[model samples]
Target: MPGYEAKAAQLAKMGADLIRPSGAPPFMLLGYAEERELIAGWAKKYGVQMFTSGQNHVRALRTLGIKKFVGATYFPERMNRVFARYFADAGFQVLALEGIDAPFAEVPKVPPEKILAFMKETAAKHKDAEGIYMLGSAWKTVEIIDRLEKETGLTVVHAGPARTWETQLRLGLRHPIQGYGRLLAEMPG
Candidate 1:
């Protein structure tokens, strides 16, 4: 992946929309302030929104005084749970929590039914939580999130699902998303 960055830049330029402008954005999740600036510039040029991981978006939002969010966490990792408690104690509301990938870490796979139950329990426990957030890229959360919303009657947002949504929004695609989550199999282009 050493030269992958350079290759991405080259491709961005070549595939950039000419009618839009010169400064098209490159959605990135693992970058610093400079990359944020570059993406912001490109977004302005192409009239596109800057796509970012929820973590980054949360950080940026916090720095700018936005203190509330409902986020997804994979399963129930001890450390991530600790972080969630910290955020909650810090006055940030966690609307939804998703991430049952503990099986990948040698923990038993908590079934989707259990996850939905936990959400219901947690939501009742934390009345300030507004919705549910799903975590992980390949956690098979899209369809689960949709189902969770139906059962719990709450809003659901998954990480990969959000990425798909943002991509489709940028590409101006309006397709029916039925199988997985709202935007799991649906992408912009």
Candidate 2:
């Protein structure tokens, strides 16, 4: 991911090409949120509606009235700082931000148990946090979201479900989706 910004336009073009054939109104849900301006430009160039995981996470938190959160992820400490700043820039109070320091490719393989434990521990330490914001979509997190919310008594927002909820709303699909998380199950599309 070192040169991701340099290659973003090309990647966006490739993504647009892959999405164009679907025949429905074209849209893209970008996996990362760091390069929003560049991604928005490419999306405009491709004439596709674009949403980023980070943006959707912020939206979900705002909709849930969660202003203070503990930002967690599978990324390294550096990326965790970046995510913390991203949330702060979006007007949220990042009570704490930490990660497992896992490499990008290894994220999907991170066990669900670790994710659940990490978030719970982080949330426990940050008693003032209203929610837990878990960045990155590659990890298997949806299954543990309900458990986290139930156990921590804090809203848990993960990237994949947030983007899916936003995309569903964009596509005019407003029906509540259960079993994923509160964002999709409770928030109006």
Candidate 3:
């Protein structure tokens, strides 16, 4: 996260459209909703709307009517529990939780196969879950959204699609794209 501000500053200087700052579970686990305000204030200076991944996950869950979710993270079980509690506090019903104890910086090193398998296995084992949340923005997931949803019949929501869907809606663009779940294909962009 030390380098994030410099990147964000570069993006803002380029007159970019919006920002979706995310990475730390810490940014979400405590007072999760506040991340939006934190990013929105910065977006205001750039004259664009902002949506943090944590808040957008909440929004996407409500949009998809995902009451029972199987939540998984790249963090340790301890942190995953905290996230589950965060979701529960936000009114989500967590069905099952799993996690790998990888550090935040190493999250991207986790192979796509591992992430997809984790999501698929979790959804398969917990059929009652309406959604499968693969949290952590650094965790690569956008490319697997479609296949994961098709394979499991559960809505797969990730940091990328959630923010993309919400950003399109806020920007009043209705262009739908495939391979990114219903959020991207039918989010009333």
Q: Please give the CA lDDT of all the candidate structures.
A: 0.49, 0.71, 0.76
Question: Local error of candidate 2 at 46, Å?
Answer: 4.6
For residue 125, what is the lDDT in candidate 3? Answer: 85
Ten consecutive residues with minimal summed lDDT in candidate 3? 29-38
lDDT: which is higher, 1 or 2?
A: 2
Instruction: Estimate, for each residue in 40-111, the C-alpha lDDT of model 1 and write its tens digit.
Output: 665565543444453333343343343544554554555456545544544566544444455555433556
The TM-score between candidate 2 and the true structure equals 0.77
Instruction: Name the regions of candidate 3 deviating beyond 4 angstroms.
Output: 1-19, 33-49, 101-103
Q: Write the per-residue lDDT of candidate 2 for residues 88-178, one digit (tens) a residue.
A: 7778899998887678798888899999999999998989999988877688988999888989999888877787777777776787778
Least accurate stretch of 10 residues (summed lDDT) in model 2? 19-28
lDDT of 3 by residue, 57-98 (tens): 888898998899997887778777777777887899989878
Off by over 4 Å in 1: 1-7, 14-35, 41-50, 55-70, 75-92, 95-110, 179-189
The candidate scoring highest on lDDT is 3
Global CA lDDT computed for model 1: 0.49
What's each prediction's TM-score?
Answer: 0.56, 0.77, 0.78
Candidate 3's TM-score: 0.78
Ten contiguous residues minimizing lDDT sum, candidate 1: 18-27
